[model samples]
Target: METAQLQREIREFAVSAGIDKIGFTTADPFLEMKNRLRRQQESGFQSGFEKGTPDERTDPSMLMDRPESIIAIAVAYPSKMDNPPKGKKGGRRGMFCRASWGQDYHDVLREKLALLESFILERCPGARLKSMVDTGELVDRAVAERAGIGWSGKNCSIITPEFGSYVYLGEMITNIPFAPDEPIEDGCGDCTLCLDICPTGALIEGGRLNAQRCIAFLTQTKGSLPEEFRTEIGNRVYGCDTCQTICPKNKGRHNRFHAAFEPEPELAKPLLTPLLSLSNREFKERFGHMSGSWRGKNPIQRNAIYALGHFREEAAVPELVRILREDARPYMRGAAAYALGKIASDEAITALGHAETAETDAEALEEIRAAIRNIEDMQKEVPK
Candidate 1:
């Protein structure tokens, strides 16, 4: 297959595989992105950065690794449901973001990516193909931007004007060379909604992120959360979408495409209590198929306490106390104490008393009292 013919053929295969858009680009290093990464790391915005983290996520190795031509694709996960219901949520009527409303996209995208690779392999027998989703360190957003797919929004998410940032990105690296698409000019001129609405101020002075302050990272990170950061976590149980929701580009985004984007049962406005009760086995059984669950059930479980705190529903007291009893991580335990303090139930009060007995952390002990006071205020129906 010739280059032009191959591009058309590959695009056809992508569309047939349920992809929304497909574009091609040549391999190029992202040296301009180096300073951005450096700033992010220095500002403590990175995760999984134990040591020796590669620059591939910001560099062009993604395209240059083994291939000369790159194919960038997107899978949209649209939502038709309303935002999750506010206050005392249980059962299905609650809320879920459109992205997580249904089957996970990682597996879906992977299945298609492999098939796309197979399609390429069949066309070019000697050509090697590499596929990447969110897990790769290569700069997917940059590649997509270069391929005329979209431009990176102020929030750092790819914004395809028509599809917005509510889409997932994937790539196919192949030895089969093809012409690269013309890069799209930045369209987010002077838009600050994504930055203005950030509750944690993860968006710094420039269009960058401080991962430590990012609610999404706070929800998924292992270990206990700082007391100062817990209350700000708000109602988000897993990841934070505030920036995306506030993006003007995403305005009036009615999810009519991507039928695969439906919520898992538990994820459809999960009860804070029931979620706190899930063990590793139960957590896996419930959220195993989710892209959010790959980090293990602990982080999500911990965030439930924070959500309950934000909800301040008396109905969630028993569940919160139960987690407080079995919770071991200082961060999670701390979040539990903070949430329980906000609930202020007799049951919660009793549990906090018990937690205070052996709990040695001075800050956590203070938060326990604060949690109890918050519960008292809530019980009195006082405005926070």
Candidate 2:
């Protein structure tokens, strides 16, 4: 088959599989991106791996057992969610970051990629395929840009005017070299809304991000927050979209990704009150197919406590007290106790007693006591 015809067939198959945008590129046009990935890996900004040898990332011969071509694809996830009003009290809010308003993209993307691979194999017998998304070490965002799928915006995200920065990208490394598409020149002409609107000050200059300061990383990282970005995390329990939300391209567009990707109504604007009541079984059932399920319940609940702390809602105190004494996850216990203490309920003083003595970690114990004192001082304002 002619390479052009093969590429067209591949594109046709991908669209049939529900992928919105498909783009192809020569195998090595993304060498600069691969080089950047190596530098990022070496610099040690949360991605904990050694820099790949050039042979590992750029050389198709090294990356795939049977080297040939590169194909990259993106699925746009636009943001048109209507979160409930912040309300008069500004206490426990009803909302989620827009990305969580859908079926988990990892599963969606995987199924589509597998089907695409099967289609290719049927057409080109003996063709080999290895597909990956963000989970893999290959430079994904760069691949999307090189594929002519979109231009990399100043925020360092692949931006399509159709979907803005709200897109999930994946690629197939294959043994069949097809006709390639020309990469688009980057079109981020001096719009710094993404940089200016970052609450955590994460975005640095033109395209650099201080992952240490990124609100998204803070919510997902397995350890305690770095004391600074925690406040910026606010009500965001999962990923952060502050950058994308501020971009002109993301505003006022009607989001029309795959219907299967649409979120459940409760998930779209979940109440903190109900999520607190969720048993582990309920947590799995509620979030199992959603993006929030990927990191497990501990982080989600811990983030809930962080939001409660920021809101200082006394209504959350009872649940917080129970979590302090009984929750199995230590971070959940600590976070709940801290939020409860900030709410200044009578339970705060007693929970700190259990927390300080039972807590083996010296640092956690100190945090417990600090929360205790802060609440006690706030309690002084109450009339006798």
- Alpha-carbon TM-score of each model against the true structure: 0.87, 0.88
On residues 254-298, what C-alpha lDDT tens digit does candidate 2 reach at each position?
Answer: 566678667566676566655776877889988888876777766
For candidate 1, the per-residue lDDT at 224 reads 69
Off by over 4 Å in 2: 49-59, 82-91, 346-361, 376-384
**Candidate 1, superposed: residue stretches over 4 Å from native:** 49-54, 58-66, 82-97, 326-330, 358-384
In angstroms, how far off is 377's CA in candidate 1?
Answer: 10
C-alpha local distance difference test of each model: 0.73, 0.73
lDDT of 2 at 299: 70
